[model samples]
Target: MNYLWPILILISLLFSIFRGTIQDINNSIFTSISDVVTLSLTLVGNMCLWCGLMKIVQETSIIKFLNKLLNPILKWLYPDSKENKEAMKAISINTISNFLGIGNAATPAGLKAMEELEKENMNKSELSNSMIMLIVLNTTSIQLIPTTVIAIRASLGSPNPSQIIIPIWISTIVGTLTGILITKILLRRRKI
Candidate 1:
C-alpha cells in the first residue's frame, strides 16, 4: 500500500502535467481534498452511530445471540478460529459490522480480528488458513443493511436511496458465494 500510493500519485501528476492541464490539476487536487474531508466528517457520524449500536448489542445478550446464530457458519469457515475466544468475538463483531453496512465501523473490529489471528499464528511467515479465509470474507462482505451507501446517497439528496437495497443484496450474495468458493478451491490446491 505504501509503495502503491506514491507510484499512483506520481503517475497521476505526470499524466496531468503532460496533458498541459496544470490549472485543472491544481483545482482537482484541492477539490478532491475538500471532498475527502467533507466525506470523512459525514461518515464519522454514521460510523459512531453504528459503533454505539454494536457496543449496546455487546453489552446486552444480543451479541451472544448473534454470535450463536453466526457460530455454525463461522465454524465451518474456520473451524479453529472460534477456539480462540478473542479471535472469535473479534471476527463476530467484524462480521456484524459488515452485515449492518457500516464498513467504517467494521475497520477496528477487522483490525482486531487480524491481530488476534496473527497472535494465533505465532508470528509465522506464511499466512494461516484462517487468515486467508478472513481475507476472502472481507473482500466479499455480506452486506445486510448497506446503511453506509444508503446514507451517502441520502446525503447527496437522492429521492429514494433505499431503492438500491435489493440489488446490492442480490449482487453481494452472489459475489460472497463466488469469492468463498474460489478461496476454498485455492486453499485446497495449496494444501495439496
Candidate 2:
C-alpha cells in the first residue's frame, strides 16, 4: 500500500511529461492544494459544530431519549452486551453520531464501546460477538442526514447539495442491511 501510491504517482508524472502536459500537471497541483485547504477548513468547521452539538446532546436528556428509542434494536443486534450498561450507552452514542453523519464525533464512543465489550471477552486476543457487531455497525453506518457530504458539496458551490439525500438514504440502507445480514450469517455459521 505504501509503495503503490508513489509508483502510481510516478507513472502519472511520466505520462504527463511524455504527453507534454507537465505544465497542466503543475497548474492542477497548485489548484488542488488551494482547493484542499479550503475544503479542510470547511470540513473542520462542520466537524466542530457537530461535535459541540453532540456534546450538548450527551449532557442533556436527549441521550436518554435516544437510548430508549434505540434500545430494542440495540438489544437485538448486540445480545451479549445488552446487559452491560456502559457498553449499551457507548453504543447508543456511536449510533446517534453515525445517524447524524458525523462519524468523527462517534470515534470516542466507538472506542469506549469496544473497551466495554472487550471486558466481557473470554479470550484476551479474540474479538467478542458484541465487538464484531459494533465493527459491522460502524463500517456500514446508515446516515439519515449525511451532513458531512452535504457540507462538502455546498462548499464546492453545488446548486442543490441536498439532492443526494435520497440516493444516500437508499445506498446506506442497503449497505447497512447487507453488512448486518452477512455478519449474522457468518457468526451463525461459526457457531455450528
Candidate 3:
C-alpha cells in the first residue's frame, strides 16, 4: 500500500509534465491543501458537538434504556457474546453511535467490543464469527441521522443539507441486510 501510493503520485506527476499541466498540478496541490484545511476545521467542530452530545447521552439513563431495548437484537446477532455483559454493552454503545452517524465517536466503543470479543476467541490469530459480524455491522452501519454527512453538506453550502437523508436511510438498510446475509452464508459454508 505504501509503494502503491508513491507510484500513483509519480505517474500523475509524469503525466502532468508531459501534458504541460505541471503548473496546473502545482496549483491543484495548493488548492487541495487549502480545501482540506477548511474541511478539517468544519469536521472538527461538528465532531466536537456530536461527541459532547454523546458524552451527555452516556451520562444520562438514555443509554441504559437503549441498551435494554437493543439487548435482544444484539444477542440474536452475537449469540456467543450474549452472556458477556461488557461486550454486549460496548456493542450496544457502538451501534447506537453508528446509528447517530458519529463514526469517530463510535470507534472507541467498537475497539472495546472487539477486545472483549477477542477474550472469548479460541483462535487468537483468526477473528471469531462475532468479530466478523461486528465488522460487517460497523461497515454497513445503519445510520438513522448521518449527522456527519449533513454537516459536510452544510459546510459546503448545500441549499438543503438534509436532502440525502432518505437515500442514506434506504442505502444503509439495504447494505446492512446484504452484509449480514452474506456474512452468515459465508460463515455457514466455511463451517461445512
Query: How does each model score on TM-score?
Result: 0.73, 0.69, 0.68
* Model 1 agreement with the true structure over 65-88: per-residue lDDT tens digits: 878988988998887577987787
Ranking by TM-score: 1, 2, 3
Worst 10 residues of 1 by lDDT: 49-58
lDDT of 2 at 66: 83
Span of 10 residues, lowest total lDDT, candidate 3: 49-58
Number of clashes recorded per candidate: 0, 0, 0
lDDT sort, best first: 2, 3, 1
Segments in model 1 whose C-alpha atoms lie over 4 Å from true places: 28-56, 124-127, 147-164
The candidate, 1 or 2, that scores higher on lDDT is 2
lDDT of 2 by residue, 35-110 (tens): 9999889878776776577678778888889889999999999987789887888799899888887677787778
* Candidate 2 weakest lDDT stretch, 10 residues: 46-55
Best candidate, TM-score-wise? 1
lDDT of model 2, residue 57 = 74
lDDT of 3 by residue, 52-150 (tens): 766676678887897898988898788778988778877888898888776877877788789999999999988999999999999889988878789
Q: Could you give me the TM-score of model 2 versus the true structure? A: 0.69
